[model samples]
Target: LPDVRSQDGFRASLDAIIIMRSNLYTVGRLIEAVMNDNEEEAMDCVKQGADCNQVNKHGAGAIHYVFTDLYLHPPLDLLSKMVANGADVNLRDYEGDTALNLAIKKTSLRPDNTMYKVVDQLMQWGADPTQKDLDGNDALALAENRKYLDIVKLLKKQKTSLIVPPPHETPVPSPRYQKSTTPYESRSPITHSPSPVHPDWGTPVLPAIRSSDPLIAPDREESITSAIEDDNTDELDALLNDPHANLNVPNSMGLFPLHVAILRNNPVSRNDMVQQLLNKGADINVKAIPNEDHDEGGNTPLHMSAARDQLDTVRILLTYDPAISPTNNEGLTPYNYAEQNGNSEMMRLLKEEQRNAERSNKSSTCVIL
Candidate 1:
């Protein structure tokens, strides 16, 4: 150690340890380090007095930019470092959003993103879920609003301790918390299928199919359609598992069970049912031929989701078939349907998906070349 710490000696020592720049200690370098997943350099900057909670021009910090799903590696590793370095988990951005809020918003683009892991870590580190953004939406509200049920479920488990202070007003209960009053039959275990029986469709209708095969019960077709429309996954599962169940059989209007599932508003269960049908070999790009009721043909499940402004379902379908761009009888692709319905969100998502598909094709072509 120096014998006497004169002002000049102190200045020299400070300059050696810290890079005094125009922004004092540029937080942009910290963000760039995170973006590149350079943990060692990020820690070095933090050790030399880089603001872990520093906000950029967009009022976002290193934490806000760490939720992406585009990287080859999980961003959680870098995120863990940020939190470990004493980054404020609950530090609000200019929009009053914490790191968790940004994670919830980005889930729309990549529903299969690592948001679940990111959110869990945030909560475990005492990120306050009750903190509202400028739009007066908390992490729970953002999750519910965006129809990210998985996040909602995760947040609900931590609700008891998430509140920093007693909330000024009681929050509205999300639909997931509501109990269903409709009676449901217990499903058989996954290994076996239940005997085919007419399911309760609330109203009796003439049998839609007449087949000698025991699996294709006359009334079962109508019942299965009803089950899909009503978001009854248990019955839907039973019908789907049966080897003879016509997964692609369209109804009187030429709409398949998958189409009906996409149109329904129940996201969590509807998504599950869609996945079940897909797993059981439902066509990913099946279209609804025009009928008197719905004169629009060439409308696949993707189109239905876009028309209904079901972004969650849209994302799910897009992940499976990003190249889908079939036009309906009216010569409208799913993007057109979104535009026709004035759903800007759906329009943006569909266009972005199309762009992604185009980029992927170009990449494939380049590899072949």
Candidate 2:
């Protein structure tokens, strides 16, 4: 049978929503629709009485998932719909992060400025630029600290009167996404405040400060990507320990350290390095930029690993984001890459993981961009 998601039309998925037993499931489907930019389907769900403000198991709403893409820019109109339907523009997720905050973090990882407009829309809809999370860092502070100058500028333009109260005045409900059996601990030493920046370069998020002279070493010698390629656990450990080290920042090739490790193909230590990076806050679904070398520009670590036949690395990444079905620039998923490579084991593992994710619906599972 053809996958319901790949159908010419959206029959199967809509059917799943109709038969869903819980409001939570209905809300989850709404998020899925919004993520895929199916406005008609999403509006139908909303009109059917599914709350646009419903928080999925991940402790986030449709707005939080909208900008998660590293490629395939999301339409700002979708966000407008959620807000129009009374979704909270400033509701914080389990991480105490609002949609604007998440948008700022993700935009820095990619070259596209589409999210800037999304942030602007959110601001116009009353997403408070000065609203702080648990860490006392507001959206403006995060943008500046992360060196998102454009976002900083946009945020600066907004006034406090634009701050809208949450549409649902009730207290936030318990997370629909289950917690991991292992208590999660963040390895990043940097908390939520705006991080220190290099005077001339702005913040170093993904901004590579190249040295003009070969003799002079850049202030920072090792990057998360370099450490992964060298398999230098010691350097990787030291790098992650710094609060300001950007784990999700892509290098010149738009590959995160996790992607580099997958391509490096160090059979003995690559898997270990992958695990180490994830533990230290690496994004399991971080993707590479599109280029001729890849089937599509937006290949994630999973796609790279499957294409290169790194079985162990594939296994490790799945554990972090069991339901990750991210497609590349070509609109092919990691599962497609595995099948194309004729890797039966990779195909089986991804299929099994997809089934399990459907059964359990790890709503708490979030891949921080």
Candidate 3:
């Protein structure tokens, strides 16, 4: 008898056998043999012209089946054999996720060490690190999100250096004020007034003035004090600009200028003056008044703005220093005020600002807007 292994004998044997017309079944059987680690049978079938990269009816190729099974219960040697035998390592399934992507998705299911080995194997077999699936997530970003620090380092090492454009310069606004054609034209050049009283005036008045003696008091004294009390903002602005003026000076009730502004309920002017003072290095954490009312205690400008529903002022204050706590003398925070007042819009704004601060603190994170 002729040798059964000879080409002529093999052809005769094949001819005698009933050949199936279904390529799908043949592909399934090929995958099954490979998955079962029947290396001899798999190699023999492939050499007989079974397509190694053929997809089943579900659009899953040979490599996909290998990857799926490997991640669930990896057979490294068999996977290596399949890779060496020309399995397409980057073939995507119907979901448009490649073998490597699937491997990454399966990483959450495996122990760290095993996942590392699987990732290394995939990378070694030409898995593109930059490839993204239907979800627009690249392997590197996924790795970073998953806290796979070592894998991220490896991917970075393999990646080409990216050429990023230098950051665009933010244009500085012009100093010249654009004149508004409004009915109320600014009466004077935007100039800060001078300090109202001499520094010594606050020390101690002479006994003649201090004594409530009617004979020594001048006729215009009461009118002058009343005028000063009525429109004292210009004087406060002047004092705020004075480098020599005491920042912590209280106007009678032991309230600083900031406290006086708050009590006066002049939020717009108060905010402007407060910002000016802050720009000049005013402390934000100082209590405005030493003793106002035990219950209605002193607060920082942030506390005042939030309690009074001054959203714009609150935003401006936060922009200067978001770390400024919203806590008041009554032990309430800014977030507490927003919540208690049922101001949903203000609450949303404060939360967004908080998130921005958090993002700023995180390394390697980019804010789009």
Q: What is candidate 3's lDDT per residue for 157-224, written digit by digit as tens?
A: 45632333457965432211222233111211223333245476663221112233321212222222
Q: List, residue by residue over 1-369, the lDDT tens digit for candidate 1.
A: 756659789989788776646234557788777777777776666666667787878777777666544443346656676677778988887888787887777734333334566677778888888899999999899987765544665677677332343588776443222322332221111122222454775533322323433222234554677798777778877887777787776754567778877755446877887887787878878888665444436788887776555667887887787446888777778887566545677778778878888898898888542
**lDDT of model 2, residue 98:** 85
Model 3: lDDT equals: 0.56
Candidate 2: TM-score? Answer: 0.38
Per lDDT, the best of the predicted structures is 1
Candidates' TM-scores? Answer: 0.40, 0.38, 0.35
In model 2, which regions exceed 4 Å deviation? 1-222, 291-296, 361-369
Per-residue lDDT, model 1, residue 243, is: 76
Count residue pairs with overlapping backbones in model 3: 0
lDDT of 2 by residue, 288-339 (tens): 7643223326878787766555667788888887335888787878787677
lDDT of 1 at 25: 57
